[model samples]
Target chain A: MRISMDLELQDRPGQLKHVLTPISDLGGNIASIVHHHDKKTFRNTVPVSVIFDIEEQTLEELQEGLEKNGVAIVRIGKMRLRARTHILLIGHIIHTNLRETIDEIDGTGFAEVQDLSLSMPAIDGPSSAVITIMATGDEELKKSIGILRQIAERKDLLFIEPLDERGSPGGVSNEE
Target chain B: MRNSQSTLTLSIIGFGAVGQGVATIVQNVPHIKVVAIADSKGVARMPDLNDVLARKRGGQPIANSNLTALDVIRTIDHDVVVEVTPTNIQGGEPGLTHVREALKNKRNVVTSNKGPLVAAFDELTQLAYTNGVALRYEATVGGAMPIVNLIRDTLAGARVLDIRGVLNGTCNYILTRMAEEALDYDQVLSEAQDMGIAEADPTYDVAGIDTACKVIILANAFFGRHATFADVDVTGIDRITQDALQLARQRGFAVKLVGDVQELTVSPKLIPIAHPLNVSGTLNAASILTDTAGEITVAGKGAGSIETASAILSDVLSLMRDRT
Candidate 1:
């Protein structure tokens, strides 16, 4: 039930409270928080890490609430789904239309986006990103990708199929 | 032994006279409900498109003036479809079209449409197999008689030699009169039509085409062989006159358009016999010549609205039982 999130937080004391407030009000139990901010060390803003426990459904509600609160997720990890899939979501992704894209994965009832590695070329528009979705099974992982493929088919986006080409469903790749 | 339970959600296509006959049995089959009924005129479910038409291969599109059988199937969520529509033997359009749609949508089917059995039997059977479902057509032949099931299951181990019978009751009735009351073929034919046994265009029954279709159906079920209607050597009793009937009576026999199919390439002849079919009129008699039992003949009322419907119910019961 513990969710680990890596986020970019403003370098201010109560700014941490601002990010944590939405998650806490969403009924998540905050276990610990670590803030690392040094303009000379990393970047302009601080990268804060959060660890909290939540019921399975609340974890989903928390994710939705945080995303709605404009919380940019750098990474998230949970024990629910035993397998994780990394996918590259390519296109005008800065215009990312995050809700629409995430809805495609959520619609399959098999996977959830756990971690996002994003590259914003500018502050204004199009970007590219990688998404790590945790799913219950390998089939569920492919189903998540298939949903993304449909979105890619309809949009100007490109869904790079995972190089971890599953030869068959139910066979977990031994490649760590 | 509770022969009743809950209602069977049934979707019916082509709500004609034969379709009503099926619905009557559904009402009586312990616990059964007719969820939907469809026809060219209209579909008796929640209204949808005013008319939906689909053009099928090698045939004109069939028009559904209102809610489609497919729509009723989706909305009502029927478990089975009873397709009793008039058949398109050559094209197998609307009948097979609806059946395929139902099966793909995960609904079982039972029907007596000769065209689907004749042309698309293989495809339909495969679909039922893939879907883990059943498609039965006991009313398709020997209406109300268990001939197909009997030969397919009971007499499975036995080698069957031939199937010879008065398959068309209308033709049998005509020939029976020609043999007995000293009536001519045309005279008996008119009487048979008046009795509602023969169609106004009695070509199917009179010309032995009906018998041919039936025997091909029997052959497929009985021997596990694919025999088309054209494969059966057909000869009608239309030519049997009063003189022939009299001569047959003199020889202690009867003149029946008796559809006969055997192992050899054969023809239907005026096969002389001492069979007591002379007394059996307006009745159906079919015989299965087998290796073990010799020739076992079963004769009874084979064709009528009620009787055909009863056969349909039996098939439905069998399907339900097997499903459980």
Candidate 2:
């Protein structure tokens, strides 16, 4: 599988090679290594993104191997997932913690709130927000919607979900 | 008869409980053939598997050859090698060497042994990848409970946040009995040993080493995190007092030996009775906290000769599917 990992490394003579060796040892073929040594911090740590393809189980060993060797992994894999779906949430979007709402979706590990746009005319008036979600696939997207629906109900807000192309009347007309 | 499916030859190393169990199940399968069998006593070419099993059941050696398990793996002409040897944590031993030989020979491997995987997970898995062979060990973690396959096959793209499992059937049985009867750890352990649920030594199971191995395997399989027995913060149920169980019971909780991969903890923890991890008896369960599926829990018989053999069969069938 192809995976991209963001790592912070010390700007030493062989710091980059030290991080790259584990990936190679664990049967991962390094695709690219982007080192930002020019933007090294005062502590001499540079942010690097390494892309590699590895066997399924090797990925875990590589991760542990890296951690054991003191390599700081910021994130692994693609930040944006496949299959994007847009949904709208209405009513007191900000009053109910918007960060929590986003986190609830992001925490699922299968889906994330990729982008959001919110509008509130008055402080007391009901607000609306449009959220674009990146999910693993259809089934995961459905689960994400299910969680959002429950949150919306408990928060007493209106949630307009994404229209399913296969089940929607507008989609049928467009197909015809 | 002309057919599209290919017949796969299999070599079995370590003719113990798990090895015999696989042979028993494969008796009904026509596509897979057992060509070679190796045990501590000797190694033999078993073209007629029924006769070999009959000899083994009758307390006679299958054959007398000077071949080591590694030697059979190297010289044998088989599509796959099923390694069912005992686990040796110190250095992953004969099983590790056997696995390496099998992968080097371009043969797939399905094993119930935890030693090699725990000792050299990265190197062995890397070897398999380099040699274009698959190494599957579903029976290593939860026996027939399907913990490894559930996370690896079903939850493919789902990112796992944390994994908590009742991985050891022996520990689970002891703790369950201790709580249910309000008995001491020693009493419950003796009962488990009498019932064949635990080994005579019982240190491996009761001391949390077995559970630690399972959690380590899960950590690597899901989170790509490698951990060893030392990494797990282990606290066994031997010190759990009856009063603690009773107090937890009053508070609507049950004491369970929970193994968490993310935290690398294997200890007796208080879980609500209604929780999915709160399973009883020899049943093993795993709760996988994934980003998309939320928390998915699976529970079943964790260890048994036939049950584990069923997992081995599943891995064998998986290999067949990939080859076809």
Candidate 3:
């Protein structure tokens, strides 16, 4: 599989060479690197984009090996399935089993609720949550949404799914 | 060595061993001063730090002021608050509230307690960022091993793929004893208790809750994952038999209470005897996996008053540098 990872490297001599040695050791072929020399991250680190290809199972070990050597893998390329999209759930979020709601989607392995932000106005008022979910492809994303829709229906919560190319009147952002 | 120009008036909450350790070390340092100290009884505001040290060393009580530590943080003129309170896993009390108040009041915070971070990491980190103050806890996971600062400061640019460590000193001590002397679990527990290495209850350390908490903290700090103790799959070393250790040793491996963030597990695992995580005795070690650097492992004394205090001291210095 062709994979790309956005890595932040220390701006020091020989740092880039130190990071590339691992990919070679893991039997991966490097495609290209987009080094951000002019730009520094908020943490004062240099960001380097590396694209490579390796066997599928070796990906896990490659990630673990990289982190063990003090290299920070900030963002992995298509590490999950396809990409991530955000959806909003309105009404009594806390009153419902929010934990279970998130866990069931995550349990699928194909999709996970990667991020969440909830706004609870009052004790009696309904709460709203923006949950970011990741899936491998468009089909899996739709399937995951279907599963979440059923969950929202059972709990009587409002599930505002992501918008398509048509862009409905009430549309959620399709990040992917 | 007083730098009155850059002096940071500091207060310490929870005047326990770790707090007292920080208090004693900061007396000789120039850039910081202990303006307030609080114990379970009450807080004592600016009582000649030397006298407070003497009283604590002599097992004497320092006179309490009318105000509590929380009140002192709000009312006093301090630049930073050092929180070394005991761990309360359930609600993350006292330490959680203390850290929140310090950040909200716009004071830099350095803490050794894992409870608050384990309980509400994103909330506290976001609070610190919003308040424009440093919330540092170097002593939380690996005690004096410099785990947090190693990732945050030294390895700034490295994208940490995952972190694996033997975080709890008490568990490491017990496991080391079992492997070295062919001792049983119960025997090592009592010996550790007698030596003051393990607590009398030993549940927190023995049952892998402490390691799990450290793993959760690493998950939050490094991976930006909002993980709790419940998220860690824990398996303590209390169940490891001497036979198992001998078998592992014979197989060129050592039984270790390994904490891994990628796996989200704090369980007794078999590590090769040659591995960096095979640290013995009270020593703690952390291995960071990154794409660029391969594997960088750090090992040091995981817990102690003076040791943990040193980590906090560096945090205070880091906060001071950021202001300049």
Candidate 4:
């Protein structure tokens, strides 16, 4: 699982390394570490936000190790929906039950609709919509797109997907 | 000009815009000679190039010989047959027959038609190989864009993993106009038709069938996939609204009718505004993903009389070079 933790580090040399060593020692892959050098906490300690991927069972050990090292743990939370994509749909979007269309993706448990912008030119004409979907990972995002594709097919809507910037579909390449 | 030792004789089987373009270019080249030109009306054998063009421009038939296109293919002694016939995706007729006859006679064939290729890619390629003749169709896909030859000749060592691009200029023009002018699909389509950028019956280009045919050719040519028109999952740009285009533009994307060779799908895809494939107007762009070369993209006029003729001329010259 991916975790984002806010740690209050002392404004001293080797303090940032002291917090990162425990994460590395716990077999955690640190994704990012943002140091708040200018914005120090009220306690006069530099606040740093660290995000990493680690096993769920190792969470308590990491917290204990950081606490033992005198690092103040401000907050820790699981970072879900790491992958995001925007898809466009045309042709009677609302008339075909837009709520159910969004529900199909959100009910996947691994994905959710983050935002939507709709436009209807006329009362009797077709409508267009762009929905932003957020998923836990790339694979989950593909699955959510598959679910939406089927819904669009069933509802007789034209589904338009964005071409991934990686120069291939589904954000996966056959590079050796 | 390098192979100026012996003149290369060519029988242009289709006397449409592409055929006339070939004739216009061949007039200045001393090493290339057009022996026969054929349109739907009739065939002109050993005809004067200037007279043929003048007659064609005057809306008159250039039929001087009783021989048909098939007859010329069998009887005429030519090094290459330039088949620029209109595409018939369903049956691949006329062009298919012309191509088969030309290859069976052990003559090299160059074509801008996609019908015969989409209908019988494997059979035509195998026929060409077995007969020890070349079958080049650079003009078939992306007009003058050097895709088929670029992968086959220049990028010979590099393995092409996939190709994605805007294959249809008419569709691209429509989409670009729709997005840029904030006009609806119908409005831009009409404007395109009036400007002669689109045909009167723009179903083939607008409905994504033309792009699908190009994808099938690319899949068959590069990926070794025996794909057909039915193999593609196509979605045209007819339903794309101006509002959707605006929304995509607001998100820093330009909607284009992109053809994916690997996926064998031709649909309106959201391309980043800054991306190379986000080419506007009647321009065609292709991004080739390769192993050694990474990503190589080429963009040019996707459809035009002279642009398509340039590709056809290159293929003919390549055949000439191969012979020498």
Candidate 5:
């Protein structure tokens, strides 16, 4: 997966290395990088976009990782920026402990539930919402979704269609 | 204290996937430290894991901290260097710079990057010889498989007649997927890229430059001939269609991006036949034909963090066995 990191840090010596340390330090394989060196006259922060490729599973925790080092990762899309996927599960996720379910989804390293939104109804009513999972590419997403659907079916939960988010079934960027 | 287990120093100029893998591997290997790790941009050194932490997760980067490649070179008084970068087309980067720097610093080198190896093999080999050091590269030809070592050691006594096989996993993967799934060229290639089997800018693999690089490594070792990437014929999998892949499979064969180097001619073959490589997924296989050994076929995981690391580890072990 190729992640885009936007950093707001002082333009100081060894700062780029500081921002990059966590990425390299965490064993992420850098792909192509787009570094906008043009100084931002507005703030002392250097706005840079560091793009790199990493395993799908490692990325979910990557943003949280960058912010810890003070890189200021403004955004990390759950759709999986480069070569991963996003899935949504709607049901009584909180009752199931969504975090644990996500952990189970991601434990395979092939897929992970990136984010979730749950809507709980009155005390005896059914609960429902959504879970956005970022899995490894399409085939992996299928495999992961297959597992999730199985889990959902067993638990009487719901898995929605991934039509709108991802494009033509011929596959993403088929022509490079 | 000329040498300390904690201060092992090694410098890596090409800080790409393979380079990162090298650094990660060296970090896990105790008694070594990465003092300097350089890429095309610049360099940095993390003496220990604590020196750098992850920001995204607000925890720690899951990387090895004991030794950055540079620390191994500068501090631990590294006995060897490992270079892993891309192969240069007209010219390469940290691949060449790293190889030269390590050799000039009197350090043995083990690189998987064929760019520097093919472009400046003679110079780097001579530099190592002049310095009385061993510049070994076991990961050059086949990413995870030990084709280099197989040639340099296993078949050392065999009269190698020719070397050929699907050396490029990306092309092989594209072709294989096209055949099985009946996918178009573009579709399969995209999937391969997303799967991390194909390069982002897949010019090298699709253009047969990757096969050419492997052929150079094989030719130099087997034929004792100076070979260049340009010397080989280039036919990328890009031009290959599902029709081609289908024709291959229908004929009871799997189409492979074969790098054939025998008697000095490097050619690429899209063979559709029932080969061992008919085995599914991103595995790499190589066949070395020798007079004494007839033919040997080996296949295994060709890429990834730990797999590439295993190749460098073998080279390090080789160096360890011969201290003098």
Candidate 6:
């Protein structure tokens, strides 16, 4: 499983190496390392974020080893929603049962509506909304979009999807 | 390069905006002689360029010869036929017949018409091949934007994976104005019509049919897909709301009508504000994804009399050089 962790290390030279040794020694493959040297904690410790993939059983042992090395573990999170996409819907959204439309996607379990912004100009006029959907992977995100497309069609809403960075049809990358 | 020894003679069939634009540009080109010019009213054979332009400007019929456009295509001893007729998507009329007759007669054809291509791409192309003549339509898709030839010549040997972009300038202009000014679709459409950016009957531009025709041509030309107007799944920009444009703007996106050539689909897609295909106003941009050269984007004026004539001129010159 992919994991992201926040670590606060001492300002001294070997602090970063000290924290990385246990992660590598425990057979963890590091994906990224973002050191926050400018935004030091009040305790004079530097904050660093490390992302890696390792066996679930070895996570606890690695944490224990880091603590023994004087590394303050701030937070750890499993990166579930790695793929995301934003889509726009224009029509009588509220009257068409926006809750049920969202439920159809959230009910998939693999994908969920992460953010939504609605705009209604008047009471009887058509409404517009931009909904951000996050999923576990690319395929799940595509399936969720397909589901939403069907929902949009049935509800007579005009659905506008984002063209990928390469201008192809798929989820837009978060890095953009 | 022009052949100085002998002049290359060609006829302009269809004296509309694009046809007149061709006439205006060819007057400066020394080696190409305009042998005939035709409009809906009649045909003028072995015509003078200045007189044809003046007559067309004065709203007078340009007919001086008894020969029709087909008759000229059949009997005129010309090296090339510049078919700048209006697009007839339904049957690819007049343009299709002119192109077919030209190719069958072994005379090269250069056209800015999309109707003939979208209607009978395979048949017309096959006909050109069988007669061992070139049938080039560089101005058909994007006016003045060198896409068909850019991929065919400059990006030679690169495997084209897909192509997608803003193919219609009218739609792009309306969307850009609506998004930038936060105006409704109808208001912006009226503004476009008043400025002559859109047709008075804006159904073709707004309904996504024009973009769909361009998509069909690109699909058949590059992807080797035998597609037609019916093959494209289209969605127009007429129903897009100003609120939706504003909401998309807040998230660093601009709504543009993008046509996907590979998928044969045209719809209003939310493009990231900084993306290459996110060109504003009446400009047209296309992103060509290829395996060898990576993604190459091109943007330029999508429509105009002289701009479209420039593409047609390129094809004519290329044909002249090839023959030389």
DockQ of each: 0.00, 0.01, 0.01, 0.49, 0.01, 0.52
Clashes of 4: 0
CAPRI level of candidate 6? medium
- The 0-to-1 C-alpha lDDT of every candidate, in the order given, reads 0.65, 0.79, 0.80, 0.90, 0.63, 0.90
**Winning model by DockQ:** 6
User: What is the alpha-carbon lDDT of model 1 when measured against the actual structure?
Assistant: 0.65
- For candidate 1, the TM-score is 0.57
The TM-scores that each candidate's chain B achieves against the reference are 0.85, 0.95, 0.97, 0.98, 0.85, 0.98
Candidate number of the best TM-score: 4
Q: Residue B91 in model 1: shift from native, Å?
A: 2.6
Worst 10 residues of 4 chain A by lDDT: A167-176
Q: Report how far residue A103 has shifted in candidate 1, in Å.
A: 92
lDDT of 6 at B72: 87
How much does each candidate deviate from the true structure in C-alpha RMSD? 29.6, 21.8, 19.2, 4.2, 27.1, 4.9
User: What is the CAPRI rating of model 5's predicted complex?
Assistant: incorrect
- Measured with C-alpha atoms, the lDDT of residue B159 in candidate 4 is 94
- Summarize candidate 4's per-residue lDDT along B1-324 as a digit string, tens digits: 222359998899998899999999889877788889999989999989999999999999899989999998998888899999999998899899999999999888999999999999999999999999999999999999899999999999999999999999999999999999999898999999999999999999999999999999999999999998878999999989999999888777789999999999998988778788989999999999999999999999999999999999999999888887
Residue runs of model 6 more than 4 Å from their true location after superposition: A4-76, A167-171, B1-5
Each model's iRMS: 38.8, 21.8, 22.4, 2.5, 20.6, 2.0
Clashes of each: 2, 5, 23, 0, 41, 0
> Which structure is stronger by lDDT: 2 or 5?
2
Error of 2 at A18 (Å): 58
Model 1: CA > 4 A from native: A1-176, B1-6, B46-65, B73-76, B263-268, B271-273, B276-279
Sort the predicted structures by lDDT, highest score first.
6, 4, 3, 2, 1, 5
RMSD of 3: 19.2
Candidate 6 colliding pairs:
none
Whichever of 1 and 3 has more DockQ, that candidate is: 3
